[model samples]
Structure formats: C-alpha cells, structure tokens
Target: MAAYGRGAGVAGREDLPVLLVAVLLAAAACSIAQAQQQPVYTSIYDVISNRSDLSTMKRLVDGLGLANQLTSGTFTAFLPDNNAWAQAFTAAGVTEAQMLTTYRDPATTLVNFHLVSRFTTIVNGSIYNNALKISDLAVNSTRSYDTEAGRADSDYGLALTRAGNDTDGAGGVQVMGRSGPPALIAANQSDIAAGLSYCNVISAVARFWFDTYFDIITKSSVTASSASFAGLVAAGGQQQWLKDTTLTGTLFAPDNAAIAKVQADLKLNFSTALSQQDAADLVRYHMTDVPFNRSAPVNPVATKLKDATLTWNGGQFLSVAGTLGRPSNNVRWVGFPRSASVVPLLDAALLPLPSTAWKLVVAKSAAAGASASSGFSSFIKAMEAQMVVRYQMDDTSKVVTVYAPTDAAFARLESYTGKPFASLASAIKDQIVSMHVTQGAAYTPSGLLTATPLDTMAGSRTLNVTRASNSAAGVQLSGGQTPRGAAAIVASDNVMYGRSIVHTLDQVLIPAGVVLPQGGGGAAGVASAPSGWALLLLVALAVCVQRWALAAA
Candidate 1:
C-alpha cells in the first residue's frame, strides 16, 4: 500500500520486467548530460523560478545557489504560489505568523516534507532504482504465515514494508504516530493533501494543487547521454516534422525503453532512429497545452478519460482488508516512512490528442443527449441558433465542436450596433461569424495544438492558451500561461458545444480593422433592349434580297 498511490506518472512501460537498477542509473545520468549540453529548456532558470510562483523564489534559488544542484538532482518540486500561500493560510484558520508560532515543530516538519536530497524529477515516471538507500528507507520484513522452509518454498520472502513521514531508527520514513488531524502534516493540510495525489510526470501538476512530487527515477533522467532531438535527427537526421504543425510542439517524451518497445513492434532501428510524430504524439498526449488535472476529477463524466472512473480514496487497501476481516485498519503501512512508501500511478491516456478526441465525438454526443427532454437534432438546432451565426451543416449533421457565444454576448452586441442582429445580411452576418468561427474545432488548450489562430468573421485573431487556465470564469481553452504572453490550456477536455465542441473566450475579442458593408447591392437601374443589332441585321438582309432579285430579272 505504501508504494501503491505515491507519485505514479506513467509515460510508457515495457511488458517485461524493468531493467536492473545499475543499468537505469547510468542511463539517467547520461540522459541528463545530453539535455544540458543541448537543452530542451529555453532558460532553465525561468522555468525553475516560475515553479515557485514567488518573486522571492528566484532570489532564494540564487541565495542557495541551488540551480545547478536542482537541475542535477533528478527531482521535481511541487511549488506553491502566492495565491497558494494565501489559500493555505486561509484554510489553516491562522495567519502565516500565527502558524509559525503556534506550530513551529510541525512547520519545520512540513518544510522537511518538501525538501528531498536524493530524488530527481524526470519525464518518464520512476520504478524503483538501486539507489534504494538503506539510510533513507527503514524497511522491516513482515513474518510469513506459511510453515514451509524449503529453498524453493519461500512464500513472502520479500519484505512487506511500512512507511511514514519521519525516519525511524533504520532510516525508513517515519509513520505518523496517530491520526490527530491530516492538517498537522502541512499547515494548509487539506489542500496539500489533495495536491499530493496529482501525477508526477510533467509540469501540469503545478497548476492543480500548487505542489507536485518527483520520482527518483524518470524517463528523462534515465535517457542515454547522447540523446538529443537534433542528434537523433543528425544520426540519420531522423527527427521528423509534424505534417501540418510549423513549430516544435512540447512532447510527453517516451524514454529509450518505451521507444525500443515501439520499435520492436514496428520492427525499426534499435537505436539511431525515432518516429518524430509518434514520439511527439505520445508526449503531447500526456500534455494538456491547457492544464488538465487527473487528480481532481469533479464527477463520473470527468473520470471517463483513462477509464479511471473510480475515485482513488487512498484507503482501498484498508477498505479491502476491512471487508476481508484482516488485521485492524490502524496498522502502519506503505513505506516504513511515508515519503518512500506510497506512490500514485496516474494515466495520461485520459487526455487524448485533438484528432484522437474526434473519435470520442460519438461518446460526447451521446452524453450530451442524455437529458431525455430533447434528442441530438433538436440540440443541434438550438445550439446553431444561439452559438453559430452562419455555417453549412452536413445533411445528417456530424457532431461538431461549436465555439459558443452566450446569449448575453449576443445581447451585448445588439446594444453596441443599435440594430437587430437576426435581420442582418451577409455583410453584417460576416463580422459576427469572424469573431466566433475559429478554424478547426474549438480545441481547448488540453487538445493537440496550442496558440490557435481563431478566425474572426471580420479578420483573423490569435487566441492564445495555457494548460492550467480552466474556463471557471469562461473560455477555458489552454494550460497555465508559463507567464505573461504564455497562454497554455489546462484542466478538463473533450467539452462539447451541442454537436460541436466549444470553448468561449473570456470577453468576445475586438479585432483591429474591418468594416461592415451592409445592403450595398441595392443600386437603381432600367432595362435596355437589343434594338441596334436587330435594325442592322434587318437592313443587311434587305440589301442582299434586292441584289438577288435584280440578278434573277
């Protein structure tokens, strides 16, 4: 149970047993070296400081000279921001000063909970390594019930360890002595606890809970030293371009092991080759260009991704054990210390690519029509009247993704124009369409592409996205902006707009230059007949007839 729910973020797993620990460590070190020599980071420090969301966090990093060590640590931090700080204080029912004074030991303990000396953050989540430090883990073996003592009859020969937050004598994690409150662990214990279950693979978890964990082993860490996108391409110049995409998209990179499996399946090179699109798809699949959180799924519908419909209540073991009439529920378990004992494995499969979600259009429509008051056709008509101003629909209109402008937005527009919107012609209609109709479906930031160019009826507009930015307010299309000018999509995906999908903008965008030429074809005119041609033809015929008559006489 200790290892079951802790920091589990899966990139890819080989069907066979994982490689030996020594093999992995060497790989991790080598992989990190290559990344630094030719970095994936634009400015490593920017990402690092932004993680803390603190202006002072960068100052702290500088003071500690922690940049190099952190980059080298193979660890990830679940940094909290100013807002997170305020929320933590609010939840604790105490000011930051009061908490510092009232719970100094716990405060110290909480800080210790966050700092990790051995762990490093890498892309493909970890599966234990040889660096399983004896000092760090206080593993105590559980006695077997079986009476068999033969060499081949070792039942439960492996240790069944328990874990906790503080270290006991053997240096394993110290289990909480008793359950007073889940709060004592962190001053803002409730929020921290919820965020703890967020996945470990990428940077998205930062948006969900303001904290995240890194595994000791990760795909990025375990990579070969020579690995580089350019090098992979240069080796054969193999890194390929996305067919339609112009820039290098962020990826949910699979490690050598995962790619090796893919290669074996495809029967390609063991090394010196990569399916750039395939690699990109897998990595991007894990990404929510907008932040999509697996941990805080709001409902059963939300859980549809990855088929993780069941809530991970952190007590499955106890519930099962209680049902089975095993030992009392209050026993210490997971890691002999909490840090190493429990881990959570999160599936990135839930968030599919934009193209891939088109496959789920059926599911999306079915779910949309589940209310029983109206069928899909009625739903489509209603949505069309409201959201879309103009567009052609298939005869058996395909389930679509519509960028909905609320009735209120329309109401606002009518007030601005001082004219009724419904009676408008093409010229007038086109402007509204320009603002609403984006090319392709309204893929929330969680979709395949980001920084989508939203086409306005007037002209084209760029609608930026960040992953963590949910439409809690409205128009939730992308992930958390890494900073200003960095709009990424985050949160839930596969949202539908009637038959179509929809992500509304916060406020309807106002474009720069465009004029509406309404009712311009009403020019007055009179019809003219072809009298000149008729008169000329008649005269020519008479002349010919007279000549013929004279010749005959």
Candidate 2:
C-alpha cells in the first residue's frame, strides 16, 4: 500500500510541468495574432491630432478651413512637424502671425500642396482606386503627383524623390517644392487610417511658386547663386516687369561667373547708370514671354527679343541653343514660380549678335592655312575681293548665316571648273560669295536642318536645306541649279561671329544664271593666300575699312 502511494505522487509532479508548457505556448500564439492586426482610426484628421509632433500641421489645416476635407477624403497627407514649420518660417524670414495675416492666401496654398488624393474611377463597370503607396515610388528617381494645390493642369503639384532601397527606412524619401531644398520624410512616421495615409516630414516644402519673379530673384536665401542676375535686373530698370504678378515669363539667368566674364568682355559697368534703351534690350533678350519648366518640350521658344529665339532640348540635362550655338557647358533648369521659371548658371550669356563672321573666317585662315583642316584661306580671298561681302560680314547690326567653303572646297571647285578660284571674274566671285550668305536671320546648324527654303543675299535666289546622311556633318544645302548637286555642311556651328554664324562646307554653292568656266582637267598653279600675322593684318585692315565705310555712309 505504501509503494502505490509514492508512485501516485510522482505522476502528479510530472503533470504539473506539462501543464505549464501548454499555457506558455497558447500566450505566444495570441501575441503574434495581435501584432499582425492593423490599427483602426476615424480619419486623416484624427491621425494628425493624435501625434504630438504634428501640432503645426493640425493648426494650419484647421485655420485654413481644410479640416472638413481631411475628415472624409481618401487622401495622403505629407505633414510637416512643428520643428519643420519653425525652420521654414525662419528661412522665409516670416513669422506664423505674418502668415496668418499678411500671407493668408499663400499659406492656404502651402497647406494644399501637402495633400494628394486617391482617384476613384469606373473602368469597364468596375471600381478602381488609384492610390499611391510609398512602395509604389521608384528608387533613385523623381516622380510627379497631383496635389490639392490650385495650379495649371500641366504643372506638377509635388515632386517626390525616393533615394534608398528601403522604402520604410529613415530619410529614404523627400519632396521638392518649386524651389529651395527638399523636405525629408521622418523615419517610422508613416501610417494609414480609414483609407487615408499620412507621412511626417522633417522640413516644410518651399512656398516659392506663390511669390512673384522679382521676389524670388531678390531673395538672398532663395537665389544666392543668382545675385549677379538680380543686380542686372535692377540696373537694367526691369524690376517692374519681374515684380508684376500679372506678367508671366521665363528668365535664363547666367551665374555670377558668366555675368562677370560677359561684363568684362563687353566693357559693361552694371554698378553705374546705363542707357535705359540698351539695358532694356539686354534684359528682354534674356527673357521669354511664356514660362518654361523642366518638363517643357525640346522646341524653339520665342524670346522677348523679336528675332532671337532659344531652343530648349529636354533630357537628363536641360540645354538651351541661343544666339551662341548650344553652349559647350550645360544649362540647368533651376526652379520656377507662378510668374516666372528661372534657368540659371548658363556658361555664357545669350547675346543679340556674336562677333563678325568675316573676322572669324579670317582668323581661321590665319591660324590654319589652306592645307590644314578647317582653313578658310580661299573663302577669305573671295570675300576680300568683294567690298559688299566685307560690309555684310563686318556689320554688327545685321544678322546673317554664312556657309563658308573650306580651301578643299575651293580646290574641288577649281578641279571641276579647270580654272583657279583666283582666276574667276570679279562678277562671278561676288555672286558665289553672295549665295553663301543668308541675311536677316542667323540660323544655327539645328535651325538650318529644319528651316524652309531660305533666300540668300544673292537677289531672289533661295537655298534648299536638308538633313545629311553623314551624322558628323548633319546638314546639306542645295542651290537653284540641281546639276551642281548639294554642298554638305562639313562642320556646323563652327563660329558665332557678330550677329552671324559660320558653317564650313565641303563644296562651293552655285546659284542659277552664274556660268562656270567649263573644263575637266586640274587648274594651273595659283598664288597662295596670306598666312600668319600677314593674314591677321589684312583682317584688321578689313575692319578699319568697314568702320570707315559705315562712318562715311
């Protein structure tokens, strides 16, 4: 009986251990289920109100009368914390009191820029909700989204840039306003409540778009790199145009370095009073009546200057082809406002006219003789023989495009005609040179490729411009006589001389009614054109002659 009692006691102890293990396992399962469940809330307003860091956002929403919209909409809110609001106010050099009083409309617009909605549409009798999640954004790329802000349909309300592979990590996402620095997303601050999503940002987005062009240009904090440009505007007495909110346009502002270089080159003194007419003309040349942004198409945009136009080529890097062929350096699209979009840090300023085409041709001939590539010795000789051609090449007032023949081109002509270019009659030489010069418009290579039949200086004669198969020399020009064929532009945008541009050609252009010396064999030996300092001296003499002739006239 005693042995049976001890065995029963041991069995009871064993059962005690098993019972404790079972209880522990059940509690672990319950905890896991609770962790996986999503939190529930009433609306986006409730979510913001519950967060201690988002007091500023809540106040702005309530003050702006936007609480009702946030209470029921399927929307996403990029809320700036109280700290962010404070920093933004400091940067803008304004207080919250001023925002509520003096800048109420802009403050309202600022709040609206933060809210984006999910679009609900019926497709094929089925409901679809196009709501964006942080996961939906591509890594390391900028994406545009529509916000509640009232802006043009073509304009982007918000530009979101995602940086890292981890979407949920800290500092992985940022939002850019029309200008200034981008606002960063705080870590683990994203939440969804009642179909509304919200993310807290560390800084407030800029409110530049609401300001006028003058306001932005003059703001030191906003445009520190563009101080020179702002000074030019002030000196030019064109502040009224930029300050006026009713006027809208685009300003291609050159940076301080570019402005300084141009000022020195042109012997300009912005510190002193300038002629209003000259200043106005210079200012107008840098602006366009229409506003253009980063998303603007690659097309010719008309500037305020009637004849001058700029071509903006859209890509990873934005570039503008102005009076000076597309600048060797890149042109950046800095930012935009409601009144104006400012593209800045241009390597060179856009001038109304470059240096004289004749001077450039003469310099090229001097630097490199007829035997070397890009030599224009023969073309120079032809121009020197014609006083009228010299006048056109040297004139700064008249814009023109010159399709200059290379020494090789003249050699080709000589080979075809069986007569040296120097032996040609003065009448024939004048006609040949005139046909190469297109007056009234200084077309860049890009302009020439797309231009219609262009009338040359040679009375009533037109040249047909077309695209060439050779990618290096992208353009071809055909004269009135078809049998003479086409002259390929060997080198395009070779020089930007005063109000004119030069393109090197492989063959001489022959206009109709001008008879060529008929022969098949090679020409006799001709006198070599001037070279070195001698050619340069000739160029100086030509300039003096041009000035004297103009002064006499």
Candidate 3:
C-alpha cells in the first residue's frame, strides 16, 4: 500500500500544471459572473445616492441643478458627509431649510467649491488643469487646485496637502480653505469611482471668511496674542487706512514679545512716547503697497516709509532695512484674510540705527570678534584719508546713501592693483571714495533698483544700479572703473545717523576717468622683477660658483 501511495503522488506532481489551469479558469468565470450582476454607476450622483452618509451632499447637488453636469463630465468631488454637514450647519447657526431658502446662492457656491472639473488652460505653452486625483499628488506636498467656484479670469481655489506616506490612504490628505482650519479626507472613503466621476468624503466643509488688515490685527484669534501691533496702529491713528479693504498691501506686524523687547531696548512707550507723525511713520515703515503671499516670489519690497524696505532670500527669516544684523521670522500667509493677502509676523520692530554712518563704521571696525569681510576699517581709513569724505559722513543733518566697501573689498582692490588703497594719490583716493558716496537721498536695495544713474559725491561720475531679473543674484552697482564692471551690494540697508543709510559693497567703486596703476604679478598679469636683495644673493652665488671653478682649474 505504501509503494502504491508514493507512485500516486508522483503521478499528481506530473499533472499539476493541467490542474492549476482548470482551477484558474473556474475562478475567472466566477469573477465575470459577479461583475455582471453588480449595477454600474455613470455619475457622482449615482455614487452619492448609494451612500446613505452622503445624503446631504446628494440633496445639495440636486437642489443646485448640478446633477446633469456631474452625471456627464469627468470630475472629482470633495464632498462633506452628512455628519460634517450637521456640524457645519450648527457652526453656521443655520438649518438646512434656511440654507436652501434664504442662502441659495451661497449654497450653490458651496457645492461648486467641492467640484473639480477637467477644465484646462494653456498659458505660455504650459497646460494647467483643474482635474486632480489622489494618485496625482505626492505625499507630504501641498498643491493649489482651482475649483468650479471661480470666474474665467480669476482663480478661487483650495490648497491640498498630502501628509504621511503615499500608501497611507485617504487619511494622508488635508484640504485647506482660504481662511479656516484645514479639513481631513476620511479614511477608506477617497477615490470612490462612479464611471467618469470620483468622490472623496471629507471631515468638514472648507470655509472662507473676509477680514481686513485692521480686523485681523485687532480681532482675529491668530493675532490675539500679538495685540501690541494693533495698539501701535491705533496709537498712530492709522486705523482708517488699515480698515479700508480697498487698500491691498502686505503688513509685517511685530509680535508682542518683539514689541516688548524693542520698547525695553529703546526705552520708549509706544502709546505715550511717540508723536502723531512719528508714530504714523513707524507704522507705515512696517507696511508695503505690494501684496505678497506664499505664491509670490521673495524680492526686495519697498515700504511706505522712504528708504525702509523688506527683503527675503527664501531663508528662514526676513531681512528688514536698518536691521542688517537682526533678521525677523519668516512670513506666514495661512491666516491672513483675502483682502490683505499676507500679514507676516515680525520678530523685530523696524527702527533707524542709533548712530551716524561714520560712527557705525568706526564702531563695527573697532568691535572685537568682528568678521574681516564684514568690517569697514579699510573704508573708514579711506574716508579719514579724505577729510571732505569724513566730514560728509560725520554730518548727521545730510541724508546720504554710503556704499561702504568691506575690508574684503579693499583687499580685492589691492590684489588687483598690486598696491594698497592708501598708496594711491590723495586726489585719486578721494575720487575712489567719493564714487561710493551717493549724496542727497538714502536708497535701500528696492530704492536702488528703481533709481539708477545715481549722482555721487564725485560730481563727474554717476553710478548705474542694475538687478538681475530673477532677483536671486541681488543688486549690483556699476561705475566708470569697477574690476568686474559691477560691484555687488553684499549687505544693504544699514540705517545710520538721521536719514543716512549704509550699504556694504563687495568691491570698491572707482570713479570714471580715474586710471589705477596696475600691480606687477597681479590680476593684470604683468610679470614682476626680482627684488634688490634677491638679485644680490643670485650674483653672490654665481661669483662663488665661478671662483670654485677657477681654483679647481
């Protein structure tokens, strides 16, 4: 019997392939029969009708007369379930009947906001579309998608962020409206297919609210803790301007902690210490006419106050003019209202420097542990060499934009000319230093970009300021005799004595028509001869060699 069983097992192994094929055929037939029995859905309406939890959404779709559109077109609907609708109704302090009756237009808009169509536009040969799916988005990334609620030219949209792992399913995605907390997509309820349409169940309704700059700084919960700025604005009597929704701009509001620190350091009470005009100027210094958002590129922006500007290089903080050493926190655009666009929180108040240009340069150079490249000792010396330049810098009454070269810049000049800056003739040195000094107006980086052909103390020459189109390269200043044709503004907007501002340059600005003596074995490539001592040593060695040869002979 054992021998017979072993032989039977051998026979079964040999016929395994035929048996597997037969079983696979039977399973496929069963799957086909099951698929044929199930009803096919052709629209999002059909899918919503089947799910009892989405009854409120289904009713809204029908009431809004969007059933035909959803039934025929390719769309992705982010619908709030019945529970979500109930929460929204309670939060809104209205019933479903009231929404459908009195707020019909808003109700229609709400439904449309959830619907994303396959509409596309070609701009600059790039195709932009509204169609999006869970598979189309990457994990831990945010993307803005246009919805059906916007007009033809304008885009009203929601920002969608996918968190966690891509395989984490519906729970990984979050939907953010313009002005409220973000809503999460329900787990296991996303990407539900209904023929050409798809449905995703969300936790809550995405909501948008209208708030002006004044409303945000004063009343918004996001800025409640930072009420110091609101106090300053009110104290300045600029409430009317901020409250005006028609005036669209970006406002950098310093937080309470920052305001407190500035008050302590400056020893001034914002409410009592400041005069009306001074307070107004202080308030305006923090604001700009340009509206910047998360989508906007980081660039040098001019503020309402002359010579006060804000700049960010996609870094962790913003660099405000006059505060070169201190950088404020990065701008947050999440909670700002539609009217303001961006109201970033600043960690420091925008104020003028306590000293004059000459004093700042002297202090910076003399300060221990100061960076060689950042120091202006060479610049200070150059100014001192020219009494007129020193006198001009010392004068607090005259508002001037001093383009001071760093120690590194002077070193570069020496390396190029093969001589120290001090070795140059007094008249030439004065011209070189004067070319850097732009008198009459204090210009920030933003101001410099607009104001080209700036007149300098060197009356014969004018400096041409040009910035790269991309703005990442920063601002450059060109004059008659620059080493690289242009000198880059390394550090900008150092507020100094009175209205005077100082910008540190990477290279020295030499005036036009002033010729610099070329250094031997320098950048000019002129070969230098051996020194007198070296020549004597070479001749002595040759004589010794010759004497040894004669003695040997």
* Top-TM-score candidate index: 2
* RMSD (Å) per prediction: 29.9, 15.7, 19.7
Clashing pairs in 3: 356-497
Model 1 agreement with the true structure over 7-89: per-residue lDDT tens digits: 24232234224556667888999989976764233232444454444433344445444556434433223333355445555
Using alpha carbons, what is the TM-score of model 3? 0.40
- lDDT values, one for every candidate: 0.31, 0.67, 0.69
The residue-by-residue lDDT of candidate 3 on 119-210, one tens digit each, is: 67699999975456766678779866667775311224667788766422445688766555677778776776778667788888876433
**TM-score against native, each model:** 0.21, 0.43, 0.40
Q: Which order, best to worst by TM-score? A: 2, 3, 1
Candidate 3 lDDT trough over 10 residues, lowest sum: 330-339
- Indicate whether candidate 1 or candidate 3 has the larger TM-score: 3
Tens-digit lDDT track for model 2 on 18-136?
88988999999888787676455677788678778888888878877788888877676777889888887886667887777776766887787777656677999999876567666
Query: Sort by lDDT, best first: what order?
Result: 3, 2, 1
Name the weakest run of 10 consecutive residues (lDDT summed) in model 1.
203-212
Worst 10 residues of 2 by lDDT: 325-334
Q: Please identify which of the two predictions, 2 or 3, would achieve the higher lDDT against the true structure.
A: 3
Q: Best-fitting candidate, measured by lDDT?
A: 3
How far off is residue 464 in model 2, in Å?
A: 18
